[model samples]
Target chain A: MFWMTWRQHRLTLASLAVVFLGLAGGYLLSGAAMRGSLSLEAVQKCFVGTPLTCPEWAGVISTDRNLRQTLLPVLPALVGVFLGAPLVSRELEQRTFRYAWTQAITPRHWLTSKVLLLGSAVTLLGAVFAAVYRWWFTPATTGAVTLYDWFDVFDQGVLSFPSACLFAFALGVLAGTLTRRVVLGMGSALVGFLAVFLPLAIWVRPNYLPTLRVDADSYYSQSGGWATDFVYLDRDGNEFGMWEALSRAGVTSTTSFGSEQEELLARAGFREMVDYHPGDRFWVFQLIEAGIFVALAAGCVALTFWLVRRRSV
Target chain B: MTETAIAATRLGKRYGQKWALRDCTLRVPAGRVVGLVGPNGAGKSTLMNLLVGLDRPTTGELDLLGERVGPNRALDRVAYIDQEHTLYRNFRVHEVLKAGRLLNPRWHEQDAVDRLHELNIPLTSKVGRLSGGQRAQVAVAAALARRPDLLILDEPVASLDPVARRDLMATLMAAKADRDCTIVLSSHVVSELERLCDHLVVLDHGEVRLAGDIDDLLDGHRLLTGPAATADRAPVGTCRVVHQERAGDQVSLLVRGAPPAADPAWHARRVNLEELVMHYLASAADTTGGGKHPAVLG
Candidate 1:
């Protein structure tokens, strides 16, 4: 079974690995170059008055945001389209499954063994991407950003990201089993990968741990946390709208704010409160997300087993 | 060794509203070359699929080599080639044989290699590049090398030209000469099995029409020819007319059970295997609202 799987998909697997490794190498090199000239230590030493001028540690962070917006929806599902979708769909579509299943082994065993070997290949590559991606943005994430920025890093961490890859592969198998069409299965895998992770990212993840509320004098004190929402309360301790506070401070227009905006809001009889998840809970959220995806992956694998056993084709 | 190789008790398969096969009960004895004969959609492939465990029965029981049709039960002892003659077109011919060796618990690499060499099939050529006849030979070589106790081929020669069909059957007969395997081959063409099979099973519209030893089936029935005017009258003794056709003023009827041939009313001759199979299939078509429709309209 192992030989057959490899023999059939060696070219596809090799191409995917090359593409993933190339992307990883690019990210690592660009990340290292971000801090090559002006190291963080130089910025620290400038404060000692030796160099007198602080050379800013300029790390490109906008690309990371773009990746989160664009690449993430399609990245992990590449394995689904190239590897997992065609795993069973090819056999079924081409009618080679009739030949494969009638051997000494059972169809369930044939499908299960092939999926395990190939699933491990994708998961290993996904780990490489996760570790490299997290390292790629390490300088920017730790230098001047809030701990809330670490949430994005955790999304690309070993636990969560690799689980998404495995989940997508398993979903591709299930789609192939259901539809028995190679193209349709690949499409479903891509769509399902986003349908699951997009909702988790938007609504389910932040709720994994309860939000910590903080009373801080200035926004700087809450910089390291994921500041999801801000509440403006009058001295009477009742929450008021931000627009009301701005208008009461005689802010005629909403378009621009001066450097003294904090003082203006403070003078409007408002105290600031923040609801956030601390940066220290990074691994905890990673584990939660990974557990959910892995659980779903296991369900798809088990269902594929049952389907292959009873499948007439 | 004389035990039944395949036994199905009231086996049936229904897809949605239509039944592809229904109430099909059969027992094929071990070591006999059996022909499962039927017309298109006569449940021949359906029965073969059930024997090979490719399909589950909607009702009733099926046993292959005294074992239930489940994963890995009788699988090692059974080999099946579907109607399409499935193979991985991407792999080389030798790689296909290697796959057979790797997949089966019992491997006969020498036998497969020797057979292919004898057939002059190029081992290095990709299966996709091989001719249809060569591909079919490779499939047969792999199957025969498995040394299964029961070999089921579903419409094995349906796609082959006459020469390929003859070559494939020759190889099969040569393999059957030595092995103790029971072969159940399904074909819509009766002439193909007339020269190959010892036992016969005929089906029509998902039901069993006739089944027994080929010689026994032939001997148990006789063809009676007489005037068309007397065709409506029953024959002498317990003989029953299975099928009949008219030409000019004469009508010939296939009668089951031996009638007294010495009677002066009609001429009696022994029925051939093709005649027996065609009569059963034709009579089945008659009862199923299909036969003689054009004739009646004309």
Candidate 2:
């Protein structure tokens, strides 16, 4: 049954090959670009900034690392949506599920075998992609990768992506079974996939980890409306007070608060607290999300089986 | 004990407010090719689906090969070919046969391959590339290769050309000759049914209008034509009148039973299987007033 399912998805396997080649080529070119810009002197210069003096935001040009890190977290999701859409939809669209289901096997058996076989393949591809990305970026981040990245790259590739694909596939199967039209199945799968995904991406992730920030000076200024002078203290215990003298003294700067009247005090010593670091914790989170997605996929699969077995066609 | 190939007790099915099949009690022993015949939407496919456990029945019980319908065991012994082409178009014919082998515990790869070769179907040719008739043949090959205990087909030849349909039917007949499998096939092509079937079941408006051995059903039934007076005064014997039409004093009546001894007034002739089936179906359709309601005939 597994081999039969593999044969059934031969096109998908070919698609996966295309995906792998594309990812690999893109990674190689991007790595070459990053390496071209990275000299030993450049690395030293990046770390040789004036300490605890002023906001260093000016020097932080959005580098390839930054872009890759930001984009990498969401790449698997798009892949998930794309790869998952055709898992069941195309078969149903072509009226082939009826053939597979009526074999000397129950609907559950048929579905289970396909899910296991295809899900494993998707997961392996995802893990390999994630591993490759990790190898390329490990020199810089050095294991600081977050659960978000792992889930986005590895866990989702194997677990969540496959689950989503299964969900979409089952949805397509149900639509096809009921409507007996492949177009309806494809359309419903797209609509349903987005309906489940967009909301979770926009509304859910932020709430999952609540962050509380306290701007002490802003609170002080609000409570006691004083036109205070900027105070600057060096790491060597040298101190300067008042606005013009503070400017000469360095170590602190005032930036405009949006397009507002009041100037906001920006401190240089402390960077914003990052809630979750990239690494083991991220993997844990990925496992949890994967578990949830797998559960949902399993539910959809069960419903699909019930629908197929009980359905008239 | 080895169970009957298929058994149903008051098995029924409903699609929302509409009932597709009701009070369908059938027991088909192994090793016989039974033909199910009906017009469009006459519940023939519905009955086949129920027997093969493709669709669950709304009421009563169904058992296939001793296992309850809907379980894996029942499905393992049963193979079904629906009215539509079921083979994946993207896969070559060989892949479809390989799928059958993987799916069925009692698969016969050699037989399937040989049959495909004999039918002139290229193993490497994808189903999508084949003509409609060729695709239908591939579906038949896949289903038959499984070597199942019970094979249920719903309009398997609906899309096939005459030659392909004849070849498929002959292949199925040969398989039956070689095995102890029970076959229940449904088709609107009554002539083919007449050629292939030993037993017959006729369905109309989701009910069993008539079901029995073809020979027995035909022997007991006769079409009688004569004057109204002669027909009315004729000995009834073991016959029951089913349909009647009158042209002035001349009347024609369709009855089910043997001829009366030494009867001279009435002209009694045995009906051909196709004509007999058409008569039952026409009467059934009329009884339900254009097939809106269900009607059962014994």
Candidate 3:
């Protein structure tokens, strides 16, 4: 199985080199460009009132805000899709499973060897990317905000990024094992990721976040017909709009207003109120979701192993 | 009792409406090389597949190296060289051999590597780039390297050129000479089987037309030539009449059984392995009425 896997993946070592060089080169050049513009002399003179330049570390961390924000989520997911699609499907496609299964070792041992060997390579690649992201972004405090104090809809934790990537990888493996076609596996994985992510990001959590609601008649009387149109929610650093008063009214049932949200609304004495404002337990939510996603990823990996081991072809 | 290296009793397999192999009972003792010969679609591969545990027999049992090998066989003890190139083409020759070593518990890695070296197969050369004969050699090397107690080959040298075929047969012969591993090889090429096989199992459709020690099969089987009109009557002590053909006054009847020397008018002739196979196939086809869809020998 290692021999077979190596045949498929060994050629990608060159591609790995190219991606690594491209990422580092892009990061370094952006940092250099930022350093040129944000010089200590210029910053001190231009923004003399603000203490933005007190620590040199912050400048280095914020070198390439756009690049970090754009590349972080996309790169790992791409790696997962690229590497996972062929991991098992290639064997079945080639019809070489016959050779492996006829050996003294059971199918379990055969699959275990492949997963242990190839999975280590994937883990190493992900780790290197994570380390680079950590190093390059430690100074540039500007980018997609983490779950530190800000509560953006995408404020998953530090591990969530890799966990998401690993989840995508496992998804790819599962797709390949089940479908036994590289193109189909890749397509299914991409489709599944979008299917899960779009709903979770756009619909589920946002509506669930603590919100404030008011009757259109009363609020519109006070603020003019503005209450009938929409309500733009600003919770932590994230912003979203509920379309019209009717949609905003549904937000109460969606978020499942907890005791804390109920108490806050009671203090304010509002008719309808669900607010996802900043709170201490936001990090706890991040940890819990990360755990769930990571556990899901683990389950996907386990299922792939089972399917590959048992499949006749 | 002398241990039988391989045994199949009432082995049967059917695919949909077609019976690929049925009621196949044969035994080859330890250290004997068995040749399973038949026409294309004659259940040779099906029987081999059943023995190797690649496909289960629909009705019967197979015992290999003392273990019943249907659902609970120790598959590792048996080495199967499939009819196609089983090696991953993208892997190097050395790596393919390494995979054999990793998968088989009793692999004779050095012997396999040495044979590959002798054949001048490149260790670092990828299998995809190798010639057809060379690719075949790599598969053979992997099978032989495992030093399995029973080596089952299905059309082992089907695609090789004449010279490569000779060399491969020589290598297989040498392996059998070194260790008394039972080798059961299936081939349509009877000439090749004549060189190495000690036991014979002749199949037509899904049934065994004839089977026994090579000497016994050859001795008991004969082709008799007489007038076309004389062919209608069965020969005395005839077990089976393979085929009958006529040209004017001359009629050739391929028969299985010893003919009396006293019969002067009827000529009794011995048949080689190839001639015997042709006769069986021709007769098997004739019984099916010589149509495009030949009836399987039930």
**Model 3: per-residue lDDT, tens digit, A209-264?**
34445543444333211111233333332323432322433434444546564345
Question: Largest lDDT belongs to which candidate?
Answer: 1
Off by over 4 Å in 3: A1-8, A13-80, A127-158, A200-243, A246-311, B9-24, B53-60, B70-74, B122-124, B204-207, B230-232, B242-251, B259-265, B286-298
Would you estimate the TM-scores of all the predictions? 0.91, 0.77, 0.73
> How do the residues B205-265 of candidate 1 rate in per-residue lDDT, one tens digit apiece?
9999999888888889988888777777636477777878777777778888988745477
lDDT of 1 by residue, A219-289 (tens): 45545557666777887888756677677668887666555776788877778787788878888888998
**lDDT score for candidate 2 against the true structure:** 0.63
Model 3 quality (TM-score): 0.73
DockQ of all models, two decimals each: 0.63, 0.51, 0.46
Residue-pair clashes per prediction, in order, are: 0, 8, 12
- Ten contiguous residues minimizing lDDT sum, candidate 1 chain B: B289-298
Model 1 misses residue A103 by how many Å? 0.8
- lDDT, candidates in the order shown: 0.80, 0.63, 0.67
Q: What tens-digit string does per-residue lDDT give for candidate 3 at B18-112?
A: 89998888888888899999878999988887777667778888888788774434477688888775788878888887777766778888987
**TM-score winner:** 1
Clashing pairs in 2: A123-A158, A144-A278, A145-A278, A145-A279, A146-A278, A146-A279, A147-A282, B220-B257
> Between candidates 1 and 3, which one is better according to TM-score?
1
